[model samples]
Structure formats: C-alpha cells, structure tokens
Target: MEENHRLQVIEEGPYADPGRYRRLVGRLVYLTVTCPDLTYVIHILAQFLKKPQVKHWEAALRVVHYLKGCPGQGILLTANTDLTLSSYCDADYQTCPRTRRSLSGYVILLGGSPIAWKIKKQKTVSLSSAEAEYRAMRYTTGELKWEHELLSYFGVRHDTAIPLFCDNQAALHIAANPFFHERTKHIDADCHFVRDALKAGLIATFKIHTSNQVADIFTKSLGGPPFSYLLRKLGIRDLHALT
Candidate 1:
C-alpha cells in the first residue's frame, strides 16, 4: 500500500477459498461506506467472488494490513461548517479489463467535509468518455436530490441549486443545454436525467479541471502525493500520527 497499488486478477496463482474471500471483502464493502480511500481496490476485489485466485486473496489481505496502519483516520463532521451541498464526479473511461466498462465515482461534501462517496463500474459500456462522465453526473445528481430531501425534513432549505462538479466540459454542456444532437444520440434516455435536474433548478453542473477534481481519487489508483492530497481534502486525518 506504500506504493501506488492497483489490483488485477492474477490467474497464475492457486485458486483462493471463496467463502473466506467473500466474508473478508463483504466487511470491507461496509468499511468503504466511510473509508473512501479503499473504494477502488475493494471494489476490484468484489468482482472475483465466484472464482477468486491467490493474487486476489493476497490483495485483500494487503487491504487488511493497510487498515491496521490507520484505523483511526475518518471523516470528521463539525457543526460549525456551512450546510451548502456540493459534489465531485469523475469516471475512468473503459478501465475495467474484463467488461471494458468504465468506472463512475462521486463524492458528496457537506460544508466542505466529505459526507458520502461511492465508485462502481458502469452497468453498460460507453462509447465515449463524455458519455461515461455524463452518466456519472446523472448519478451524482440523484445522490444530491436524495440528500436534499433528507435535509429538507430538518427544515434546512438550500435556496440555491446544488453544485455538481465534473471534469468534462462536453458533459457539463450536455447537462446545461436542452439541444439534442447526433453526438449524444447514443446515450440512453435515462442518462438524460441530468438535463431534467438542471431544468428544474435543483442542480448546477460546473466544469473543474482534473488536477483539482477530488472525485478522481475514487475512480482510479493514485500515487502517494495525489492520494495524500485527496485524503487531506476529504478531511481524513490521522489524529495521533506524527507530522
């Protein structure tokens, strides 16, 4: 884990026991609910449940060891911060070797602190990166709406549209504009929910450059500096560790 670790199913190793692997990874899936740093690796391991190999098992064990290194690190929600809702969404276009499907990830922040995050493979293959990114935007909007409703029950009404940050300008434009054209014809009708969310004045899509896109960490493997950068941004602090 000290290195920029990425996971792939290693077939040359002996087959691993499915029961143990599933149990271990199942727990990690729940851990990912609050531990966004482990999202990408744990999600990769979950795919091989039926026919896990030695390398896959080893990778999962490595994750267990990594957990020991920072059991106390987690998101800290303070009451003093603002209640504004913002989100960052990103995708790894066609990075899944087996299905050739892209990965979509989004992070929801409450008052500049991360409250929720998730990453998973797209259900269908996307023909373009823009399409993949657009799909992620739609999902982000959905999460925003759900959170908005929950906050409304508490009498916290946001007078402004929630900001959904995305790195693809084409995807941003597609969500903001009502025009229909040949380039976006292949995208499914359901994916166009982003447009509806925009039209309703419930969401605002904005372009952010990749370097500052914190959601980028959730979708792909990152080096030490980049990973550390995101960890800091997510407010993940090792409270007792030495600086």
Candidate 2:
C-alpha cells in the first residue's frame, strides 16, 4: 500500500468509471482518522466525483505519492505541552473554479501542537476578502466552542477564551465591532455569531500577517517551501523520529 501510494500512476487509456473512482476516494477518506494531512487533498478531489477526468486521477495519484514518501507521518499528543487553546483561521477567496465559492480552514492548538483542523467550502459566495475571512473565523470559533465543551466533560477546565489568529485586518475589525454597514448587511445572520462571541469574550481575534498564517496550507495549494514551513509550524513531524 505504501509503495502504491508513492508511485505516480499516470492515467492511461479510457477514464476510470465515476462509480469506481468514488468508491476508491471514499475508502481513502475513511483513513483520515489517522491521516489528517490527506483531508484537504481528498476533499478537493471529491468535488469531481460526478465527472472525474484523467487529469483528476493524476492529481489524486500525486497525493498518494506524497503519502508514500512520508509513510511515518502522524499526529502526536504529548503530556508535557501546555493546555492553553490557540487557533489559526484562513480562507481562499473564490478559489473554486466551478462554484466560485471560498474555502474556509482552521487549525486549533492545544499548547504548541495541533489538536483539531478542517478545510471546508463556504456555503455562500463572499463579496469581499474580508467577508471570506470572517466566515472562516466563524467556523473556527464554532470548533473551539465544541472543543471547550468536550474538554469540560473530561473534567478539564479552560477558564479563558481561545485566541484566534487571522491574516485579514478588516475581518478582525468586523469581529470587534457590531455595527453593520451596507457592505456587511448582506452576510447571513448565522455567520455573524462570531461577532457576538467576540463581544462576550468567548473568543478573541488577533491579527497575523500572511507570512505567519499557518492555516494557509489548509485553504489552498502552496509552493513547496511555504507548504513545508506551515506543516512544521503546525507541529507535525516524522513519527519515526520519536520511535
């Protein structure tokens, strides 16, 4: 399986049937329980389930090849790190070529290691970059709230609000203030819940420059250097190193 993942099986002859391709992708997705790194790639590939082309197959194969080359990669939860919660939020504005919808992504850290992360397409189209970012922040806030509740159930009490980092200044401003303008009036009421959370001190928003936005890797495809950099920043290391 490792060897197959590493080999770039180029598409040849007729395209694979959509049903078969969907099944293969479904099986791969089930593996995400232990392979979060594959989440974004698989989700992106799943978009073409209805009409997968040879090019799409090649792309999926590349993801498998990436996994094969780094077979020992996995998440680790250490006892030594602090338990304070911090989150990074980001979005790709209108990245979907087919739907023109933005993608929202976030990573939550328990101390310095990643504990939760996700990449999902926004349900509605955003009119501006700030709007897209705000939507992303909302999603991250929801995740943080859920994590907070789960920890409480385990008798772990976190007294303070989680600090969420974002690259967009305008989005940060919007979250800090409740007054809505004509520009922001069109945003759905549900998505604006983050604003209330910010006002109530349930979550805090901090500005981070694009260079330091670790969630960037989840929102879109990046170059080799940036991609590797963000992965390390998220505290993902070779699993073999510990063994």
Candidate 3:
C-alpha cells in the first residue's frame, strides 16, 4: 500500500469482481504468516472484499508485485539460546478513514525473535492518543501474561519483568501510575490491568523513541526505506537472495 493512500468505501463506483478479489485477498492473508510487511496492507484490502473496486484490485496486485521481487523473503528466527521475552506496542490514532477507529499493533519477541504479532482496530473511539496507546499496552500485556505462563509450563523461568516498550510517554506514565485521574476516566476500566501487570512484576513499561518503534510496520503503511529497516530489525530475510 502507498504510504499516503487511504482506502475509502465507495458506494457507487466501478466495482471489481468480488470473487476474484476475495480469493486474492485470502491468499494474501495466508502470506502474512511469513510476511509481516504485508500485514497492514492486507488488512486494509480485506475490508472491501464484499464490494471491491478496481482501485482495490490494483492495490492487491501491487502486493503480488512486491512478492515477485522476493519470493523467499520470510522471518528467520535466530538460534540464540536466551529465553528473554520483550514486546513493542504502538497505535495509529484514528487512521481508519471511514470509522475513525484507532489501529493498535504489537510484536512479541522471544529471545530476540518474533513469535507472535497482531494488528486490530479499537472497539471504541479513543478521544486521545494516550488512551489509544494505553489500550494497546493493555492488550499486549495480556498476551505477555499468556506467553509467560506458556513458557513457565515448559519449565522456563523468567525471573525478571518482561519489558514492554511503547513510543508514547503518556501511555507509559499511565501504565506505571496506579491512580485514576479525571483525564483517564474515559479509558475502559479493564485496561487498568496494564498497571496491574506492572505491579505484579509480569511486565515493565519503557519509553522508546518513535523512530525505534519497530511495531510501526504493523499498525500503518510505511514507505520502502523504513519498511525494509524495520523488517531487518525483525530478523526477516531472503534466504535465496543473490550474494
């Protein structure tokens, strides 16, 4: 997807064949398992499956062209023996052109290799970027907790807090502070577990610079340079690329 291009639902337009578009998007969906770079664009394309337009078909084909450039591109988990777990979470505030819903995304890494990732739209409109980021932190905390327990079940001991990095300072403050202020009252009460996880030593919140926020690739469309940079940060590679 183009970084500046935003897809909108057009009620009356030259529509593409829904069947073909749906099948193409489905194959793209499966590609996401090995192509983190495709996650955001495919999510956008999947939205108009029922009423795809020619523009949408073009966008889908753009992804196919991208794949043609490097068919062997895929994530490469390192063989490092460290059992450390860390996560990066981020949110693109109100990016959906039609619904004004925020998109939240996170990537969980085990021993510096990504093992789980997700991108989702917030259920309710966030009145502030901090709230949207806080919600993303909460969702990531839940996943961290589950991952922690799963590792423990297999006798992996993680004595230290799992570091959860976010680019928003306000969200980091909210996650570290236990008290609820009037400004934070609008956020869902359930999201407070991010703070709980902090106190329970299950996770620790850290402030990261936006440029270093690798999870940005999952939440929004990025240009080629930054996209390739973050993809390299994830340890993804093309094993068959010419040397």
Candidate 4:
C-alpha cells in the first residue's frame, strides 16, 4: 500500500506449487466480495493464473498479511436507510499487461452504504480513455437495473433514476449526446446502451474529480492515504481502531 506500488509478473524460477497459488488466489477472490479494498490487488494476481511465478505468490502473501493486520475491517450498514441507489464508475485504460484491455470497476451505494461492487476487465480493448470509462458506466447502469429488481423482491421501491458519477467529462457527454463525434466514431455497443439509459432517465451521469472518485480504488493500485480515504468514503469501517 505504499505510494505508487505496482505488482508485476516476475518469473525467476518455477513457483513452489501452482496448486497452492491457485488456492490462495481463489480465497482472495472470495474475500473481495466483502473486502472491496482487496479487489484490485486480487485482479492483478489473477492474470498469471495458469503459470504463476515467485513474485506473484509473494504479492498474494502481502494481501493476506495486510488482512491479518486489519481483521476488523468490514462494510458498515444502517437500518431503515434511504433506498436510493448511486454509483461511481471508473476505468483504467490498457492496464492489463497481457491483453492490453482496460480495467473497469464500479461501486454502488444504497443509502450511503456499499451494496454492490465489481472489478472486471473490459471485454474489448478501448481506443480511448473516455471509451473505457463510458463502458464502465454502462456496466454500472446495467447493474443498477438488476439491483432495482432485487430490491423490489424485498418490498423496496427504487423508481428514481440512479445517479452515476465519473471522472471523465467526455464520457458523460458521450452518454447523453445525440450527435456523434469523430472521436467517438469507433465506439462499441456499450456506448449506445449508456446513451439509451441516459435518454430514458434510467441513470444520471455526473462529472467528479479524480480524488473523489471512490471507484478508483476498485480499478487500480493506490497509495495508502488515497486508498484509506476511498475506503472511508465507501463506508467501510475499522472496528479494531481509529483511522
């Protein structure tokens, strides 16, 4: 969690055991459902799944060690909170070392508590950062629809348009503009879906500064201060001690 720390594929020799590496990675993946802070790190480790190396194993161990040191960390919730949904979406363009695909992530908050979040690689390569971010916003918008259905099953009504935040202004423009620009000419199906959502009033897109983009944590490795700041913004609580 140091400033600008990055995990790279290092293959000095064979890993002690490929099986153990997979097992550890699997556990970490499951941990991500509750431990949002671990999502980006686990995604990095997963790239070398078939043939993990010494450095990958060591990096995985670091996540485990950090968890051991902060066992009391967890998502905090409030009863009878507002049922409205709001999401922050972001993308790291061409972050995948192997495929050069963009990394997309979104964090959805219900009544100000994180109810759903995901860290995924984009299905196709993005030619621009705005395209990658717009794709991420569409993914978040689709998730909002599913989540609204889930809420309905439990007698909760989420009829209002969900607010979606992004750090890229061009992506927001792409989501609402009826006219296409040469810059967005080659965009994929996701761009159309997001524009449709915006026109249909299913989601509201807004521009936010990079520092306040909580979804940033889910997309890449961050320094300790910023990482801790975003975790707090997501309502993740530390029961063991003060921040």
Which candidate number has the best lDDT?
A: 3
Q: Candidate 2: where is the Cα deviation over 4 Å? A: 1-14, 188-192, 241-243
Among all windows of ten consecutive residues in candidate 2, which has the lowest summed lDDT?
Answer: 1-10
Q: What is candidate 4's lDDT per residue for 1-243, written digit by digit as tens?
A: 443444553557768798999999998898887888888888888877888888778888988899998999999897878778899999999987767899999999999899899988988888989889888888898998898789899998877788999999989887777877787776756778887877777788888999999999988888878888999999998898875
Runs of candidate 4 with Cα error greater than 4 angstroms are 1-9
Q: For candidate 3, lDDT tens digit of each residue in 75-161?
A: 887776597999999999998877889999999988877888999999999899999998898889889999999999999989999
Please give each candidate's TM-score.
Answer: 0.92, 0.88, 0.95, 0.93
lDDT of 2 by residue, 3-44 (tens): 212112333443567777787787778866666567677877
Residue 220 CA displacement from its true place in model 1, Å:
0.9
Whole-model lDDT for model 3 versus the true structure?
0.86
Q: By TM-score, how accurate is candidate 1?
A: 0.92
Model 1, span 106-183: residue lDDT tens:
999989888878897899999989989988887888899899999999998888989889999988777766778876
- What clash pairs does model 1 have? none
Note the Cα lDDT for every prediction shown.
Answer: 0.83, 0.78, 0.86, 0.86
Global CA lDDT computed for model 4: 0.86
Better of 3 and 4 by lDDT: 3
